[model samples]
Target: MEEEHKFIIRTYSKAELAHLYNPDMPLVSAMRKLRQWIRRNKQLSSALAEAGENKRDHSYPPLQVRLITRYLGEP
Candidate 1:
């Protein structure tokens, strides 16, 4: 018999996301930098690709917190 592995995906609320980026900075600016960080880091492309699979809204694509942590090395 073969064993199957399951992974849990984590999603962050706006407040949590902002804190992860920078608790000392403004939330709006933190989010902007987070987006820019994602764009510049090509290694994070796989994480974004996974996010695309479960995207709910076209205007606001969902980002996986676990994947972000994996690539970004946690907050």
Candidate 2:
């Protein structure tokens, strides 16, 4: 899913994404780091907020996931 190689964009759980980004860290810490990264990016944060902010939400919608990947460059 790194390049344009026919990757299928899909919804991802927060925990799943956190694990993807920081498998070396504990789950909670990893999730916190992911959230921190999102919050730190103004463009990404605003876009997500416009879509409907819900930090407590368990998973990301397909489109929101797209934005995340676009901003964060594919977990």
Model 2: per-residue Cα lDDT over 1-75, one tens digit each: 576544357888899878887889999999999999999999999999998869789998888888888999875
lDDT for each candidate structure: 0.62, 0.86
Tens-place lDDT digits, model 1, residues 1-75: 999644334556645665666878887788777767777887785567756733342222235666676777666
Worst 10 residues of 1 by lDDT: 53-62
Measured against the true structure, the TM-scores of the candidates, in listed sequence, are 0.62, 0.83
Worst 10 residues of 2 by lDDT: 1-10
How close is each model in CA RMSD to the real structure? Answer: 9.0, 3.5
